[model samples]
Target chain A: MDLTFTERENAFRAECRAWLERHVPKESLGSGDTREGFARHLEWERELFDAGWAAVSWPKEYGGREASLFEWLIFEEEYYRAGAPNRVTQNGIFLLAPTLFEFGTEEQKARILRPMARGDVTWGQGWSEPNAGSDLASLRSTARRVEGGWLLSGQKTWCTRGAFCDMAYGLFRTDPAQKRHHGLTYFMFPLHGEGVTVRGVDRLDGDEGFAELFLDELFVPDRDVIGEVNQGWYVAMATTSSERGLTLRSPGRFMATASRLVDLYGRYRASAEPALRDAVIDAWIDAEAYRWYTFQTVTHMVDGQDVGASSSLNKVFWSEMDVRTHETALALIGDRLELDIDHDAPESAGDAVDEGAWMRGFEFALAGPIYAGTNEIQRNIIAERVLGLPRK
Target chain B: MRFAFTEDQLLLRDTVRGLLARECPPDVVRSAWEARSGRAPSVWAKLAEAGVTAMTLSEASGGLGMDELDLALVLEEAGYAGLPDPLVETVAVGAPLLEAVGTAAQKERWLDAAAAGDALIAVGFEGQPFVPHAAVAAVALLHRGGDLYAVPREELPLEPQVSVDRSRPIARVDYAPDARHRVDAGDRAALDAAVGVAFDRAAWATSCVLLGLTRRMLDLAVQYAKDREQFGKPIGAQQAIKHHLATALIRQELARPLVYRAAWSLAHRDSVRDHGAHVSMAKVHAANAARHVAKTALQVHGAIGYTIEHDLHLFQKRAWALAAMYGDVGFHRARVGAATLPD
Candidate 1:
């Protein structure tokens, strides 16, 4: 098996590395969860879209370069290596876009994909509700048959960046007679529609990163429904896999963090605990392992094998590794862990530590195991589905 | 880039796996513990006939001319069977080392026999205290003062050491390096470098075997969890047991790619530092996976797993023994750290 990148792939990497180096801001952008920060992130998204970098794996008709998955992975590596701002439109681009590509009608694709890629209409996930999480099929949201479309009514909580997003897509029970996983229809609706209200919720990091959506008979046209009605569970499972697997959390992200952690350890090597040193090394190795694992996965996908339940294993690993990488960085930061470093600080600040970025990163990493399906539920899926363990 | 074994490689792996299933079952492994030679010669001969022993040797030397990447899965199959032989020592390490540095006369004397599985060559690295299969081998290659010596087994003084897994017989070979025994008489420095790369190949091979042993332990645990019932249901129904096996499966799945990547690095002959780091990473991860899976398998099997009467102990002991060989987790981790972390 050949592991070295081809000449063309290396060229693609060089092109991406050059673009990211030139376009990425010198200073980190503000949290995309905040209103002003969302606007700023939107500008970066537009720049990426203009440069055909918004959706590298998507068809060119939709503002993308129609790059291969290997190229997409290369772009991600360059993206994170350049320390680019977090994608404020990730829920739409990463999670929903794959489903849309798979299940969206031609008309839906034409209307949604281009604007979505261009950041004209940002999208947030509306899957998890107050009652439905790990057991997502038990969602209480309903979509009643209407004259032209469906009338949706329910509460969708933890809609990441939903407070500012223009639209969302989720599963709704279309026929109450059928129990869990049945009778659900996937629908996309505008957040500011006639019967919808969005309220921001403060997250652990004190950012309005999550929103609660109250849908009161919101009218969604039949055109917005993805895939077949009553088969929404299947449609949404596609999105869940994307969220929990490769699209959302690429190995490049963790490798970048691991690199930073190594640098941080070097800065504190004189005073860092020996255990912390080992932790840094272990985290680095884990990241490297994840990178190769993803390559293996892409190889299989290229060979026509489906990821299926094995993505849960990927989720469990990267999510935990993300936490460990950040935790190690925080440990190296020592008592200064709680310092709220100013994002707007000058170039020379606090011995070039980036101050509280590690703390903020730690907070962000904390959400990984919780979101994209909790690690516990992923473990169950792995045991029963992947390993064929008996499920009582 | 393709990061997977080719069809031929996989076919070869399956052939070895099927052969081992028939010839080196648990009973054979059990018999090796009591055998005077601590080996199953029948299985070794079958592997030779199947071209496994000659895979890494050159075609000019009556061998397959395959590289580490081709034999990786085959090595894993060997580990899966817990075969009581010096396949890794002779095939993965010995033949290749001889092919690379052995004189033409040396190749004529031992390489052809090794490729035919008629002669077994055991290897002992400098830092390692014990030489595996030294008592049964026709010749033992020992490292001293950075020079490799090929001493005939008859001339070598072997002190047998009882391993936790008796199927794997290891020993201390006390042999003074002599001019006659020195294999790399032409270029000592180049020989030293070749020996260093051979050590990396050995480590990578051991990692592949560790992965196979880990998978075997996990499979036993999963099967046991399904069969062994408690509280009116199979114990596998319990979340604790399921989660334990699930975690082990995750480790196995993740560690495998690292091992495969190491095989690629060795096959491609990447920069010495890069390949060295890659091999160490593979060793560290595979060792961790084997260690964790062994514990989980034992815990899931309860007291039965502890007994020699049960088959689980065979793989568990093999995993434990191999996990510490070549380089343990901490040793490999430090190697990776040295390559990765800033000085």
Candidate 2:
């Protein structure tokens, strides 16, 4: 029941706050999904890596501080509060790294993690395909055995930053005799490898945020296989849990957006609708509730409890909350929300009230529910797995 | 930062939950509906014997001297059982208010009796018109002109009011202000501060109760969905019913942590900044969660939940009653709105 941070935790918070205050870029970077934006974000990631702030929760051997989960959360809160650049390495760092740590071999860890942390390599997730989404186990990608490696041949769509990412990790069918979740193997391979083609897709924000990968006998060596063959479904479940739970969408991100919404409300209070005030307040409360909820979840994790199916609940809540928070911000900003305030424009530069950010944020928040397993899928998981409802 | 209940706190909650399961089941709640007293006194006595009635009282007052965090889970159990009593008023709000602001003479006379379960204290804040259990209380603490007055039940005139949840018998108390009835005669500033904190405690406790009631309603709906058959399968097999319950569970799961954090904030108010906002956040979230669960539970239950014979209505009604008690969702949201979006 102790809610206050320990003296040590508070000290860590102070250190993070000071570091973030000094190091956060004076100007916002472009969206990390684009090629140019991705390169710009790599610079920021390098700064974080150089300062040992890139992967605070990872082991020191992996170029991290080995910070406690609580410290990691504090770091996230401070990072978001400072309006720091979005983590371009989030796919590799938050989602893939946990699974890698759990399943990667000593050699694999040595070769992969440090470089990934340093932004020398960036990763994209290759889970969703054209025919496989909510029912992910039905993916048709195959990994036929070859000499010293496997030949992968399939199409992976909705690959986040796939057009520019150095590598990708995904599940592929390894046994033609088996179906569904069976006979699948987790594999990581370079996007520039032989017989691999990547096409960028324009997203809702009109950015090249997604990519479609066409693999025609792409070779991935045995050394790149993560976890045991045919057990990739179970291993990939761990990665999905990270994506759907605490690792990917921490409460600090929403809290930061909620705080910005409050400031926006303050600026528009005179002409804002009274109902908008309640929405703004509800957004703040939702963020605060999410923060405490994460704290409770983190406490349980620290106490040696597995998050398991409950991660579905977290995914559903925060995704919906993120959408509502941004929607509220857009509503408060009124007609100015229509303005396409270009970030690169000199007049809009350094302006705190960037109306376009809210629109862009709203577009981004809409994807929260769709990605990391759609809310519909997450709800079904919660119903059947968590609540023990009938699958039929 | 550990945001969880201690073993002792959980034990105390379990003890009360077990007592309520045995003594204040759905039948007991039903019995309170038509009973003249509108309460289960034996269950209250059992809770008092378990030291739940005096959990927040000072040690000198023959109590455990615990804080709101200790009583949170217990009050939640009370909400789960739909316990028809003034436990929140007497223990969580009234007794603590007296301990904080009552004079030496006042504490000497009522505190011991309150801790011993020999007396029931009903509280009515200024904004709220009806005082719950005022007719049955040993004393009624009425707010008047920013001051508090403790009038003996015998001296207080009460007009009984019918409520949607029959287990909660509320009344409007009519009492003239007098020097003898003034509980805050010692220090006006202290009384004002204590009264403010008392309201926060009331809201936080009520939110805990609402969460408990919500859990109860959701469980009932889930169980019923599993048992009832429709279109050749159990209704729970249907995605519509399953999704409804799942959504309700999500709301409850998220709201519970906020309520717990509010308990922590109230317990550490001296060191916590803007603690009232924390309480308001809990109240709003809990109230909304309870309301949503109640609606979804009824929807899942179909026609049975609408009937008075079903047990779901008992909890649903209790949730509705308590969701608006202390402060409704809108009221608490406004409080939060002011704090976060202040002019």
* Residues A129-183, model 2: lDDT tens digits: 8999888999999999999999999999999999999999999999989989999
Cand. 1 TM to true fold: 0.98
Highest DockQ: which candidate? 1
State in Å the error of residue A337, model 2: 1.6
DockQ of 1: 0.86
lDDT of 2: 0.89
lDDT of 1 by residue, B207-229 (tens): 99999999888989999999999
Worst 10 residues of 1 chain B by lDDT: B264-273
Report the Cα lDDT for residue B246, model 2. Answer: 84
List model 1 lDDT by residue over A1-392, tens digit each: 88878999999999999999899997656778887788889999999999999999998889898898899999999999989989988999999999988988899899999899889999999999998988899999999998989999999999999999999999999999999999999999999969999999999887888999999999998999999999999998998999999999898898899999998888899999878888998998899889999998999999999889989999999999988888888888888888764545424356433747788788989999899899899998999998888889
Candidate 1 deviant stretches above 4 angstroms: A342-353, B270-273
Query: After superposing candidate 2, which stretches have Cα over 4 Å from the reference?
Result: A341-353
